[model samples]
Target chain A: MIGFISEKLTGYLLKRETICQEEYEIYLFGMAQFFRKILVDATVVFLGILFGKAWEMIIFLIAFRVIRIYAGGYHAVTPFGCYLLTILMLFMVLLSLHFISWNLSILTAVWIFASVLILALAPIEVENRPIEEAERIYYKRKVRVFWILENIAILLCMVLHLRMGAESIVLAQATLGMALLCEKWIHGDVRND
Target chain B: MRKGVVKMVLKKVAYHEAEKSAKIICGWFFYQPKLPNAVKKLRKF
Candidate 1:
């Protein structure tokens, strides 16, 4: 659906001289993905609000975005598939958030597990986003630092007994772990042979 | 629709295409795209 819309929109943009014909392919795709994301995000947010799980959705989005920026993950085989996987990922995060909310101990466990994955497999690159050897070394260190800072944020929330904030970190870590698994072990695209 | 909405629409298109192209280019960067399906399929589920 979005792919189709983006095509038509691309035509419209070209006609209006908003984007050059030479650059329109990328622009077409960029617009399609942008609207697709916006539409997807709005739909997910609406669902979250309707189900009274708005906070979970918000936390999941934030956590996923933060980790995803540094730790690239597997891209879907196709554009539509990518959309499906994204929604699925968010749903998993929200579902697990409910379970983790049952006990702070579980949240602690999740945090530790996520920390391990980040330490072990972050700066997770893929065929889609190849990195230079030097760049790879740099991102590895950078990603770990971000992971530690995120963990610290969770710890602060935990110590203060700010349950919601703490839970957000737990949710974030869980989301990160899933992305890592898909990018590393599942896709089997690690840098090492 | 408003004029702002139109511009936002254009920007979004550009970004999406840029992102996708970036990924495709990266795949081409390594031998990933050129890999024999036989070898890669062995790794697949």
Candidate 2:
């Protein structure tokens, strides 16, 4: 029943008229909701790992799966640039945590949660104009930023893997692939537009 | 009246296409088309 409602809402929101006049508040609210959802999922995963609770891992996976669907279905999905930024931030925290001795994993988890909160509450403006030029430029800049952050995150993860012989690099790739696949599924093709 | 509205939409679409083409051409020369001006022209038409 909830799925049906979500599908309907997704359809309604993706329709042209429904998107023509979105207010800034609406965009902010949407972004906040998206970020909140991600934070909850990440917390679940982190806590699950900390407590060695298999159930929490299951719950985290389910939560991310839902996020994947939601993002793909909604045209107002979380911007890739922001997603990449969050991933890079997570990578940095994880790497830095390795150098510290005092329950650094907990600190990394906290950092991830805090970053999620900050992104959720960040002041961002969306130009909801109908002009293609403005939209194109906006997306172009966004894609560029995403590209840079993604590359840096990937590189850092690889570096850490080389130094520590950890599987975190593979985990990063899997996570990134899932995100890209989800985005592609939602957007009907992932080749930039 | 609905037909007129459709025609207006089509006109705007055409304007957008032309503007995109102009931008592409300008991009080859390391320039960007004036988007605000293009949008203004579109409104004028």
Candidate 3:
């Protein structure tokens, strides 16, 4: 479906002479990406509304993206697979948020534990896309800055008695920690074999 | 004059979108800064 739309857009662009044949692949990939992002975000927003946790969903996305961008983990094989995994992950996070009776102490503990996990094992290089030393050093430093900022925001929420806000951020942290661990385990197995 | 400006702006936007899309295709779908050009080249090689 996304491919068809992208192909149509590419054909239109080619007809218009806006992008030449040489640039076809780039535009097709970019437009498909543009559509994929919109689809995922729209679905997430719709789910958040349905669950009445739109605010928390937004918070989770920010916190999670900030960490996950640098602390790379668990890439699905295909674009469609990635989309499905994202929806599944969001459902799990939102459902847990709804059901969990989160308290300040528990949230803090989880945040601390997740912080440790992420700091220790993040930027985990998959066999396919290994990180270079320069990139590793750069991303390691980058991830720490975001991690500290998240901690401060959580602290502020706690001081302000915003339990739900803190819980959302902490849950995001825990989600990344689990993702990192899963990726690490998978990487280890591949290495052993 | 206006058409030239519009074309230039569209070109910039297209470049930006292509860069971002390439990164997400390489990594996961999320906000990530473009890696240094040196690193990008080295990875490609």
Q: Which candidate should be chosen as best, given lDDT against the real structure? A: 3
lDDT of 1 at B22: 44
In model 3 chain A, which range of ten residues has the least summed lDDT? A184-193
lDDT of 3: 0.70
Per-model TM against the reference: 0.75, 0.28, 0.81
Residue A172 miss distance in model 2 (angstroms)? 4.1
lDDT of each: 0.62, 0.35, 0.70
For model 3, residues A40-72, the per-residue Cα lDDT tens digits are: 778777888889999888888788877786778
Residue pairs with clashing backbones, model 3: none
Pairs with backbone N, CA or C atoms under 3 Å apart (clashes), candidate 2 = A72-A186
**Predicted candidate 2: what Cα RMSD to the true structure?**
16.6
Task: List, residue by residue over A65-84, the lDDT tens digit for candidate 2.
Answer: 32222122112323343444
Superior candidate under lDDT, 1 versus 3 = 3
At residue A136, what lDDT does model 1 achieve? 65
Best by TM-score: 3
Restricted to chain B, the TM-score per model reads: 0.50, 0.50, 0.51
TM-score for candidate 2, residues paired by index: 0.28
Interface RMSD of 1: 9.7
lDDT of 2 at A20: 33
Model 1, C-alpha of A160: deviation from truth (Å): 3.8
* lDDT leaderboard ranking: 3, 1, 2
